[model samples]
Target: MKTILLPLLIGLMLVGCSSSPSLSNSSSLYQELNGQSGLERLVDAFIQEIAGDEQIFHYFAKSNVDRFREGFITHLCDVSDGPCEYQGDNMIDIHTGMKINEADFNRVVELLINAMEAEGIPYRTQNKLLARLAPLRPEIIHR
Candidate 1:
């Protein structure tokens, strides 16, 4: 009975696995982003974008640029499956008191998109990276 059940379950699992198209391999997204130096450039560009935006600049006015830069670089790297681990505060903890509204949060996203464009990341790759990071929205926007 045990042997028969095991084979039956394995067959069902194999059928289920093969039923859907597999997603693209995401492990190398870090390399696609051009690795460490590219991530640094992205962070720097994002910072500059935030600095230049009137509405969004105020949110980062009192924040330390160096801290933000390093933390963001690490976070991006980790999310893209790079070698670095994120060592910064969790998103919720860092954004809890910010009272960030949806519009402002979206503006920040737009700034990030702009930064990716500046870094010459292809549109499809940008979408891939954005999808990887999209789960952080709830943690960041605390109403």
Candidate 2:
């Protein structure tokens, strides 16, 4: 399934949950993400990853690269319990008319995992971050 403005929805998974004690309410995951600068780097790499993916690039080809970068970084920080807030649109609002489906949403998750791996984030830290992201899934897919 394909969708429009998928890039704007990239960081939607990074917010809306804070129940996890290890990563969501603590700065440990943020530290693992290398703080603000590291989140920026991760967003940059994620954009590059999306740009290089033939399957995904077309969806992002018309996106505002700068906005995605900044929003993604801020969301990453917020999601990782860093000192930042995700000031972008809510998940439902951002993805409502896009018609995003399960496969595409999962693909984006895969891309995020790839970006995290490229950033040298450990498997443990990565899992923690993913776990934090689980609850927000319902707000995103098929919206």
Candidate 3:
């Protein structure tokens, strides 16, 4: 009985070590954001809110919405430590001629917060993501 128990415990330990890491074992913010699907939803909510806001609608007038959504999701995912690559232009290049002011940037941030709320993302998680993104303001705000 003792010999059998020893082999069983060793087998269990080997199985545990051989198992692949899952979301449950991951501490990535991407997992916290629910991965690609959740990020996609968050981006959609943000775009929808921005589309109706007079102050920012014009900014997207000449843009490709679908591509923007995809890239935004990728960007957010990458920033959140997810396994996604951002294919969009760098923030500096993207906003170079946009002349986005502090007020404009703030408004977008507000809209993003609203979007996060709309998507049922917790406030703490939202703040975590926002904190990660706050450093990009210098590149995004041209004026």
Which tens-of-lDDT digit does each residue in 1-143 have in candidate 2?
Answer: 34645754654544524334555345578898788888888888889889888777777777899987888788878988888889899878877866777888788889989999999988988898889887888898887
Q: What is the C-alpha lDDT of each candidate?
A: 0.90, 0.81, 0.90
Model 3 lDDT per residue over 1-143, tens place: 99999999999998998795764365778988888899999999999999999999999999999989988999999999999888778999988989999999999999999999998888778888999999999999973
lDDT of 1 by residue, 18-37 (tens): 88665455348888899999
Q: TM-score of each candidate?
A: 0.80, 0.77, 0.80
TM-score, prediction 1: 0.80
User: Where's the lowest-lDDT run of ten residues in candidate 1?
Assistant: 19-28
Minimum summed lDDT over a 10-residue window in model 3 is located at 20-29
TM-score of 2: 0.77
